[model samples]
Target: DTAVSQTPKYLVTQMGNDKSIKCEQNLGHDTMYWYKQDSKKFLKIMFSYNNKELIINETVPNRFSPKSPDKAHLNLHINSLELGDSAVYFCASSQVGLNTEAFFGQGTRLTVV
Candidate 1:
């Protein structure tokens, strides 16, 4: 029973392939998010869905799309993945307040060859 978890902690692939990263949270939080941690360790929020409704959307590539089936899970699906997408994809969650601390998963490192 983890608060937030992501699968395939490491990912390495070719430049033009399709891949997906899965995220899940069991903290009973209404808002869940996806973040991309670059080589510089900069954590940028990609998508945030609250109660199945999208709230925060960042400037990400069109090939990268986030799908949330429910409040407990959010998944990232990438099509025609590029080398630029080679970064650590993290799943995070936080309460609907800035004061709340955001929790993160171990992350999946997607490497495009």
Candidate 2:
């Protein structure tokens, strides 16, 4: 009975490789988000999706793409992965217009060697 779930909990790859991480939620929420945690342990929002529509944050690099196939799923694809992209990626979900806490996935730690 997981509220949020992400695939490939650990990923290690060479530089310039393309990879994707997937996320899904069973909480019946309308909004979902992707966040990145850097090596220094700082977290930032990378992308957000509401009801299958995209709402990207300006600070995110163009190489990272978030695709929401439906309200319950949001997948992240990174092209030309770089060392700077190595981080713990998290997927979270919250109900629309609610002041409640967002549920997060276990996270996928991506390492570019």
Candidate 3:
């Protein structure tokens, strides 16, 4: 019984390809976010949305895009992917941002060959 689950725990693809990851949460949370964790395990917030409304986008490249069709679901779409984009993508959920604890999914490993 996973609370928040993301499709394709591992993804391998060639460079300059496009990929999409689907995410969903059953915790009834109102806010969700997408984070990137590099090889160094340094985590950073990329995009956040609440109730299908995008609320935060921080220093992320245009190739990465996030879409939330509903409060419990947010999907990631990448265009023209690159080798540098290889990393673990995490989907997280929170009641709210300020001083709130966000639950993270296992993560999807994207490898650009």
* Model 3 bad stretches (over 4 Å): 97-99
CA-lDDT, candidates in order: 0.89, 0.92, 0.94
Which lDDT tens digits does candidate 3 get at residues 1-113?
Answer: 89999988999999999999999999999999999999999998999999999999998999998999899999999999999999999999989857898999999999999
Answer with 1 or 2, whichever has the higher TM-score.
Answer: 2
- Candidates 2 and 3 compared: the better one by TM-score is 3
Score every model by TM-score: 0.95, 0.95, 0.96
By TM-score, the better pick of 1 and 3 is 3
Residue 8 Cα positional deviation in candidate 2, in Å, after optimal superposition: 0.6
Error of 3 at 52 (Å): 0.7
Model 3 clash tally, residue pairs: 0
Highest lDDT: give the candidate number. 3
Q: Please, what are the lDDT tens digits per residue for candidate 2 over residues 1-113?
A: 98899999999999999999999999999899999998888888888898999876748888988899999999999999999898999999998674767899999999999
Listed per model in order, the count of residue pairs whose N, CA or C atoms clash below 3 Å is 0, 0, 0
C-alpha-based local distance difference test score of model 1: 0.89
